[model samples]
Target: FQISYAGATDSSVQFIFYQPIIHGWRETDFFPCSASCGGGYQLTSAECFDLRSNQVVADQYCQYYPENIKPKPKLQECNLDPCPASDGYKHIMPYDLYHPLPRWESTPWTACSSSCGGGIQSRSISCVEEDIQGHISPVEEWKCMYIPKMPVFQPCNIFDCPKWLAQEWSPCTMTCGQGFTYRVVLCIDHRGMHTGGCSPKIKPHIKEECIVSTPCYKTKEKLPKEAKLPWYKQAQEPEEGTAVSEEPSFILEGWSTCSVTCGVGRQVRLVKCQVVLSFSQSVADLPIDECEGPKPVSQRVCYSGPCSGEATEYTPEKAELLYGSLQEFDEQYDWEYEDFTECSESCGGG
Candidate 1:
């Protein structure tokens, strides 16, 4: 005999299962020391693994697995063995053929604005170079055109603030069966200071809105977990939580090519700022009037030294023979050379 059954609409079915929490961590073997013999350094790093497939993941994942484990050092000194003596050539200190020229240098960074989360920090950089007399002199931006300028803005101290601070709420703890609410609670003072002022009893509730109902069917599609914590917070509590806009400020562009390659010369470059009306516009596209802050120096003196490679060095006597008198020689050939090559190579060995 065969039996057939029909079910009414809206009938419900429930299944229960448990997934074990997984923790995985590992340290790589040390790499070969950097130096051939003398002293050098070696390195290694700790990493986390995916429990289900045993594949390597980001190191941060390991922290949640083996709770309370301390971080390990990734670098160490090694290769203490001494090197053999060199074969006869004396070691001479190397020097840059070009003189210590002027260039831009960035000062040390200032302290972070806040102890946690988001805050702004900045540093000042200036053009500088050494003069022929061995003195450090502040040069015009143009004189330091060889290198790119350093940026003055950067982010710092971006980790999660602390436990007392209120974090946004998590999704409803359960789909439909028995649901509960959850959120992050940080302990801190009114001024956002990491203090114990928050009373244990008054802390925002971590669980709420409980309900027992039929289980809702879940789809196989899932959203990936967020990887980074929010880095910044508003300076003041605003209703919309929008960021305050800073006034437009001028930022200097890298120096342009020198107008003249050698001798006392000059160079010029355009400077611009982020004008409110020119949002997302390239620097060159912004009009000069849009630059609201202090205008950057558009032109500056660039001393590349007297034009070189034009004339070769020759003895005073040789100069006199060619130009008749020392006075005449000096007048006609103010620029001089040390010696004429067997073939004035620069002059095609004339």
Candidate 2:
């Protein structure tokens, strides 16, 4: 938000821009249960609310802001206790015209047996009879034999769960001392798969900052590229219209992994310069210097849950046993990168 004002001493005018404001989601109170006895479900939903306006607003106001995420609706269980029996004696009564017809029923489906490669989920199938009071109870399967029954089990995940796989790390960026090394990482599912289901919080680091213990004494320097040059020494004038964009912006990539595998850590992203042509609106990469305006934030705090209580840390040798070893390096001795041990998040996101 910005406002322009005229100067009292002159005709010149200037504008002042306001800083962005923070927004959040607000959940409504849960509604009453669907049932007074047996199992029941109650629900509550989220709404975008404005503190200053004191009113509930459209979802676009909350959703459009990156930091303001709409939370999942809350679901609660109520009236769980089973209803008491009507009579102390148990007897088989003859079927009558007033009774409701018995029907086949099934319980909720259980979790998938496997996350990928085709798995099965099952539910308990039974015949249920409803009494005059509208109470339902399990009855003998033969009671509903005339009706077609639902399958007791169903197939799930014709192999859709994708796993994160990391390529072997490259040789250290520096030959004689610690620098940087990186590798490729990807998310892959089976025969048919959809894009963008992978969790961003647990993604592994493509580049590791520290490695290679070999020591060296080296200094790198740069020479000036511009100075007054004679006509004979100077090259031909550069071609015209080489620059494509009138305005420059930043291209922010996905965030890198946390600095720590467990507990609290710092995560950062890559912000590169980009060019957007005014005429065509086509975007292209540009050198960092070309970009204008305050840079977008590329770093934030992250949590990968708490560290395992184990006394020892997981090492590369242990990872090799599980994931299989990559090619060996020629260096006589160097400390390998530690593997992500184990952590359990109590809540979602950092």
Identify the candidate with maximal TM-score: 2
lDDT of 2 by residue, 270-296 (tens): 566655533234554554544444443
Model 1: worst 10 consecutive residues (lDDT sum): 340-349
Q: Which residue segments of model 1 deviate by more than 4 Å?
A: 1-98, 165-202, 205-350
Instruction: Give the clashing residue pairs of candidate 2, or none.
Output: none
- Residue 99 of model 1, lDDT score: 35
TM-score to true structure, per model: 0.23, 0.26
Q: Write the per-residue lDDT of candidate 1 for residues 274-312, one digit (tens) a residue.
A: 322122222222333433333334444454545667553
lDDT of each: 0.49, 0.56
Angstrom error at residue 321, model 2 = 48
RMSD of 2: 32.8
Could you give the C-alpha RMSD of every candidate to the true structure, in order shown? 39.9, 32.8
